[model samples]
Target: MAAVELHVDNRLLDDFEAIRPKLNGHEIGRRSSPVSDDVTVLTMEMVTAPSHARTMEVTLRRVDDQLRVGEIHYWDEHGIFIVPEVPFREVAG
Candidate 1:
């Protein structure tokens, strides 16, 4: 699989870097497998701290110089801190 360019701007990258230390370093780990011509599935495995594993899949669409992120859906294992169910930062209960 070839590496694709990210569509986001530099500021997003900078922001990600700024808070890099806080994240567990597993939020954006992606793996890819080919499905057919012009179609590929990306598997993003997420580990939400202490001990958990969740995976998500997103479709890729090729358009000239860039690959667009298309149709994202996931098989969530529902870890302690990921997605809409949990907050990015924990609130005192």
Candidate 2:
């Protein structure tokens, strides 16, 4: 995981709907994996018209019975981009 930050342009956010995360290509809710002991990797996909799509690989780690985001990797027309932890943040005043 590299120290990186990404901000989605307003145009892309307005064009695509980001759906739920998918584990092993299946949509999941709340808990990611049936086996809690294993590290879970989920893919979140957003798509828009004209064959444009973005896929984000989210890595989760178990922490005292709770799952926490570990690393994130995003894929788009520009290729893969990685962030060490949480990728998005609200702008400070």
- For candidate 2, write residues 3-92 as lDDT tens digits: 122333334332222322322233222223444434332333223111332445445566786555565455545664433244688899
Model 2: residues with Cα > 4 Å off, grouped in runs: 1-53, 78-93
For lDDT, the strongest prediction is: 2
TM-score of each: 0.28, 0.30
Worst 10 residues of 1 by lDDT: 1-10
Model 1: what TM-score? 0.28
RMSD of 1: 11.4
Taking the tens digit of each residue's C-alpha lDDT, what string does model 1 give over 1-93? 112212223334444344334433333332233333432232322333222334433354656754554543333255233343444787899
lDDT value for model 1 = 0.36
lDDT of 2: 0.37
